[model samples]
Target: TALAENHPNLLASRHQLAGAYLADEKAIVILKKVVEMYETLPEDHPGRLALQHVLACVNLRDGEPERAVAILEVVVRNAEALPEDRLNRLVSQDELARAYLNAGQVKKAVAMLEDVVRIRKAQPEDDMNRLSSQHYLACAYLAENVVEMMAKVVQKGPRRLVS
Candidate 1:
């Protein structure tokens, strides 16, 4: 039954249901509907940001990182709008950086990751998030063969873990 879904509770059932679609060929269609619903939801509605975040993932998985970049850039701009929602912005940045890299735009990827590293370093966040940005930036540096920078990041070992 539709009621028996991946999301454990009613609170996230709709979003969770979307997850089921994420795994199926039907994902694209379901995602389109989700984007529509998401657009109709009120600004600052409790679940809206999460929904948009998921939609961005769907776009990426559908092999449309450029589209993901568009969605994520908007999400990034709103990072400070919701402190609790900042994680989504961070995630989007990570994906957007990769999208740029995949598109043969390593310079842009490195630039994006550089900004990510700076923001994450300046703010208080979960240790994992800090680690993620550090790792991503490190890889971006390495990919560009910025050996000096990569070595520094490697030496640091996830800024939080280093300290």
Candidate 2:
């Protein structure tokens, strides 16, 4: 139904629907359309980032981390420069870090995740987000064999329950 019309309001919803389509054929088609719509929008338009994020997720799920990384790099770079959207910038950075990890760019992933941890920590003390980002950063450090960084992050997080 979405493929038949280019309704601006439906673009976001279609992107969500695309995620449920396990078959790449349908998903890619819908995603491509969404990307096209986003491309036509202003460069700073939030919808562009949202569509790009969705496309990156699809790429990652399809075993195309490199492609995901490409999309997220732009998203992260632009989001980071937007001082008004600090939270969006941090979230985009977090996603880009995950994409970097998937692409085996461990060093870049660690750096980006570190920034996320720092930014989250500076917020009004949202323990859950702080701990989640810290945990992810710690895991990234572990993957890179950087025990020191992993130890620092783990120490800052809440103690785990011993079974």
Candidate 3:
């Protein structure tokens, strides 16, 4: 709790502690507090979406997949609404897709990822946005192991990303 005392609003530290506690049975209170802190933050805050993703992950680890799914759904909706920052939205979408996978909503995860892949593919090859999308999509693909596709995705990292 030293980190929390020093930086109460620090999202990453809170998320890390919650993640650790989630593996134990004594985590509900800590996780709830972390979620509360994050929930009060403005939607567009830098760590807002990341906090939500962590909360959802904690919920999943707690065997509360329904709650995790609900949180992720809202995250995806919010992501879709933020047009000025499409890359941020994409990151949220990627997190939501992972939530879906964790909740065993495989179909939803695949469907969401299909769109992510399409959008990434349409980006100008030299754009960082395309590279990020590819990175996340590749991660999702590896998570699902979609028919030996990992080889193709694994090979594209440095190539897709132009320094």
Q: State the lDDT of candidate 2 residue by residue for 20-50, as single tens digits.
A: 7746668878888778877877776788887
Which predicted model would earn the best TM-score? 2
Ranking by TM-score: 2, 1, 3
The C-alpha TM-scores of every prediction are: 0.64, 0.75, 0.54
The residue-by-residue lDDT of candidate 1 on 85-147, one tens digit each, is 366667767777876665556788899888778878866666787778788778777777765
Better of 2 and 3 by lDDT: 2
Measured on C-alpha atoms, candidate 1 has an lDDT of: 0.69
In model 3, pairs of residues that clash are none
TM-score of 2: 0.75
lDDT of 3 by residue, 1-163 (tens): 4455325556566667766776675566766666677666777555666667667766776678778888778777767767734777776676677667777666677777778768667678877766765665566666667634655766767666565
Q: Rank the models by lDDT, top first.
A: 2, 1, 3
Top-lDDT candidate index: 2
Once model 3 is optimally superposed onto the true structure by TM-score, how far is the C-alpha of residue 35 displaced, in angstroms?
1.8
Model 2 lDDT vs. the true structure?
0.78
Runs in model 3 deviating more than 4 A are: 1-16, 19-22, 25-28, 83-88, 101-106, 122-163
Could you tell me the lDDT of residue 43 within candidate 2? 70
